[model samples]
Structure formats: C-alpha cells, structure tokens
Target: MTVLYRRVLGAALDDLPPQLLALHDSADPRTWSGQARIWRGAGILSRLIGWVMRLPPQGDAVPVSVSFIPQDGGEVWQRDFAGHTFMSYQYQAPNAQPGIVNERFGMIDVTVAFQTDRDRLVLEPMAWAFGPLPLPKALLPTGQSFETQIDDRFVFDVEIAMPWVGQIATYRGWLLPTE
Candidate 1:
C-alpha cells in the first residue's frame, strides 16, 4: 500500500542534528543491535504504572535491538530490549506538522524539538488519544532524546513521567548500525 505524503526527511527535518539524521535515514531499511543499561526511577505508583506499560525492570547493561522498515511515506520502528520485544510503532510524517505515531495503546502526536545542548534531538508529546477520545498530554509525560556520543555511538534516552507519580520509567542506551 502506497501512502501518499511528503518525504520522511522533508524540510522540517532538515535542521535535525547530523547524527540523528544519519540514524533516522531510512532510505535503506536495516537492523541495528547493541548493548545498553536500562533504569527506572523508584516510587510505588511509578513502579505500578511501569509494570502496566510493559517497561523493563531496572537493570544493568543488556542487549538491545532495533529495526527500521521504510514505508511509502514513513517508517516502522521495532525495538527489543534484552531479547524481549517491547513495542513497535508506525510513524506517519506529515507535510508540515508533527509526526504521528500509532502504538498499541493509542495514537500520539510527537513534535521533534532540537535542544541546544550538543544539538540533541528531542521528541515532545504534543497530543494523545485513544479510540475517539482525546487524552490530556499531561497525563502522559514522555520524552525521547537522540544524540551522538564521543565514542561515535548513537545514544538514545527515553523517559515517561506522570504527575504525582514521579518517573514511571527511563532507559538510556547506545546503538551501532550493523549494516
């Protein structure tokens, strides 16, 4: 099925950091595997929510794998942590709007914001909805960062926080493209 839309890396994505641009350059689909350490903040409520979200338990460094499959207008991202498949998301890149992500739970609108700190690229949640009901963005505090480390590894960090619940989960890791 051909999805009619602008290129995945359009003008809006031109300002992205070189490292991020390279990492997300999905013109040729491939898989990358590496090792990473995962961490989750502590709190009873946070732990409970993390469990419900299928987040990995706090642990030392483990193996992580990711695959990027290009589509007509966007891509599919599949991630596995420590040999366990966590989640897969289908992304749709709009012509002049934030990218849309369709996950198992719901659909989320994500805006890519560039941080001055080392030209890091951050994914900010703009809107979220389940079924036909719109949900408050505050209810789902999610953050994602991509940066290049000194060792030339592509680093990725993700955090999900909820009001009064502290940090539900967080994971930081580095990856190297295998092919």
Candidate 2:
C-alpha cells in the first residue's frame, strides 16, 4: 500500500528524509502520545525560566502528545508537554524561501531552517519577529537537534539561552508512536 505523508514544518512530505517521513506517516493520525525522560538544565535562572514556560520540574520521564490537523496551507501543531499545551501555527506559502519553516508561537513569528543530517532531520531557528518588527538574531540564544534511533524512536534536544541569563532552559527526550 502506498502511504500518504503530509507536509511537516514546511518541507514537502515526500521531500523529507525517509526515516523522518516514516515517523510522521503513521497508521493513525488523530491521536498520538509517548513518554520520554525529560530533563531541565541546572541553575536557578534556568529553573525560573522553565517555570514561566510551565515546563514540568526536572523529571526522569514525562508524557507528551501532539495533535496534528491539516489546514489550508499547512498544519496546526498542538503540543502537550507534560500536561500544558503550547500551541503554535505553522504554514508554508506558495513562494516561501527554500528550507524555511514559518511558524507563529502566540504572537511571535519564528522562522526555522529545515535540513537533513545523515539519517536525521534537524530544525534550526533562523529568526524571530513580533508583528512587523524583526528581532536581532545575535541577541537570542538558541539550539536545536532531532534524531531518530535505529529502532524508529525519535529523540529531541532543544535549548534556549540569553546573554546574561545564561542557559535558560534545555530539554531532551525520546518518543515513540503510541499504538
């Protein structure tokens, strides 16, 4: 049977790395959940930032889920971390720049660069903006990494830091499709 893969982030479903595509192209789409060993970076400021974001306190494992719904030009990614939902809007315009995934976190515009590294697909934050004003990238501390294990499970590690605030928050976890 031929499987239909939907666009994720901004890359065409078929153009994505094979392994990465398989992860998103599951038998069921309505609901998916998994568990991971969640971790919060050290330092008081990092913990404070985590609290503000509503991230679960440093835990060995936590539950996460994503509800993906197709829209006119893109998809709605509603992510449930631990239990809090961080909603984001994603879309791809007809003439969008190559390798760019445009997303809106609340009112902030976030642009991410999508690329393939070996067998993994990586998403790197490129820029951010509020309304029509663009924010200086140099003033933001950002990091991104995503990889799929040999067994088909996925692992993600992301961190955001500020100049004097040091490492704001970092979380890493593995996830698998729930049957």
Candidate 3:
C-alpha cells in the first residue's frame, strides 16, 4: 500500500502545468506559508445518518511514523521517524445531519514529504495552527533517491526507487485529472 501510494502521488506531480509548477518552485520562499494548504482529517461519521458525532482532535506533537519495505521482498525493513503538529483547525460536520451541514476549514501543503529512510530526510516543525511556514532545509535529507511533491493547483506527484523495484512503473495516464 505504501509503495502504491508513493507511485500514485509521484505520477500526479509529474503532470502539473507550468504555471502551477512555478508556484511550487516558489514554495520554499519566506512567504512560503501562503503557498500551501494544511489539512487535518479526523472524527467518525454516523453510519445510519451521515454526521460527525464524535471527533478525535490531534495533540501538540502527533507522531508521523514511516516504514519502508525492501524492494527485493527482503524481511529487513527500514524505518524513519515521527512528526508533530500542535493545533490545526478541525474540520467538522455541521449539525450532525446528512444533507444539512456547516462549512469545513483546513489547510493543505503544496508538497508534503514522508521520508521513510532516516538517512535520507527528516522534517523539523516550524509553525502550526496559525499559518503555513517554510520547512527548514536542514531537516531534509541530502540525496534524492526517493521523494514526492505537489503543484500549486493541488496536483500531486512522487518518485521512488526501492531495492525491490529497479525504477518507477505504472499504467499510462496515471496522473490525468478526471471529472
């Protein structure tokens, strides 16, 4: 599932438009916070009636863990680390109703990285709940053997080369948007 996710995300980024690509390139700017969106998905919906009755709010330092599977189907798995966020605005269902609902609020990032290889990359928290901020480069890994990115228009793309898989592979038209 992780491998499939990486491949799907990578394909999305590869198909972004030139203008959107520029937005993503300028993403690491001082005003970078405004360049991306933050998103938090939680809470359970009522099965009989579609509504968010109870919600699970995230804590100050939530653990974002990563696990890597060897390409050759080896038992030796490589694992990375954890990431944390303090208070992100919660997106809740309105009035606990099926059709009737209040609007939701959340943020998103132009590009989000979950580097499984600790030797490759690490993300250091900057700011949260207030506005988007630039992710420090020091926290990022040196080599780019595997990674992912999303464009300004919310178009995502990713690339991965594991020991098991020689290179990236997928069905054609993998990144095209469908209505």
Candidate 4:
C-alpha cells in the first residue's frame, strides 16, 4: 500500500531528499530512535494542555523513539520522548486536495496542508475539529511543524501554540532508523 505522505505528495515524492524519502517509504513497521530537546511553555494553560495532550517534559537530549504502523489507507504513529508517550493517526483528508492530510492527536483532529520543497516537508494546519464538531481555523493549535534532512540526519521540529495561550510546547530533534 502507498504510504500516506507519498500518496498525498504523489509524483512529487521523488523530489524529496534521500533522508526524507528513506523515512517515508517503508512497507513494514519502522522504528527510529534518537535524542531530542523539548521545551514546555511556562504558563498554566500551556502546562495543563500539555499534560492533557501527553506532551513530553522539558529536557535536553532526551531519548526519543518513533514507530510507524501502516494501516489500510493511513498510518498510526507512536512517539516516545524520555518516558512520556503519545500517538497520532495520519490519513488523507477526505474530499480535499492532494496535499491535504488529516492527523488526529488524541481527541483533536487537525487537517494540515503538506508542502514539499526540495528537502523539507512542512505541515501547515488548515483546519481543526474536536470529536465530530468543526473548529475555527484561527484557534488551531499547531504551528510550524516540519521535517527535513540536516547534516545526514532526519530532523524534525514541531510547535504547539494556541491563539491567546501562546506556545504550548516545541520538540525538536534528529533520528535515525534502527533495527
């Protein structure tokens, strides 16, 4: 089966850098391990939401592991930073353009537009929903989630921020495929 990102990116997948392509083109379950730095927001709202969302605690060079399990038309991603664990689901956005993908982190479902430019894959949030109810685009919580190949490593940076609450958390790191 075609991977979710490859399906969304279509023929454009060929244009991605080798490191980026290596991570996305797996036919079997894949696990990558590495280290990361996590920064949590200092506000009360940010902490509460981070806890509810199972965001990792702030730490430098924390152990990180990511496992991707393929599904029918989507994939389930399990992530671990330090000892904290979280998971998300990814699938093609129904009735949307080729570059749009729906990702659900816990109860919050987010639609993101995927853009590939040379070596970088950027995920820009375009819509949000909780359960079955649609949410305002203005309040979508994700900001500047992207992945790229840097210095022969698969690097990722994801920022979670809301309208008035400010930065919820940012986890940035590099990983390599592990047996």
Q: What's model 2's overall lDDT?
A: 0.63
lDDT of 2 by residue, 100-179 (tens): 67777666777777776666667787888876788888755476555555555656666666666676666676656556
Each candidate: how many clashes? 0, 0, 16, 0
Q: Per-model C-alpha lDDT, please?
A: 0.62, 0.63, 0.24, 0.88
For candidate 1, what is the total of clashing residue pairs?
0
The sequence of per-residue lDDT tens digits that candidate 3 reaches over residues 21-71 is 333222121111111111222212112111121112223322222222223
lDDT tens digits by residue: candidate 1, 56-167: 7777788888887776455666788886665545555344443433443323434333343445655566556665676776775666644554466777877777777778
Query: Per-residue alpha-carbon lDDT of model 4 for 142-171, expressed as tens digits?
Result: 688899988888999999999999899999
Stretches off by above 4 angstroms in model 2 are 1-19, 23-29, 41-56
CA RMSD per model (angstroms)? 3.8, 4.1, 20.7, 1.1
Candidate 1 Cα RMSD after full superposition onto the native fold (Å): 3.8
Ordered from best to worst TM-score, the candidate numbers read 4, 1, 2, 3
Report the candidate with higher lDDT, 1 versus 4: 4
Best by lDDT: 4
The TM-score measured for candidate 1 stands at: 0.76
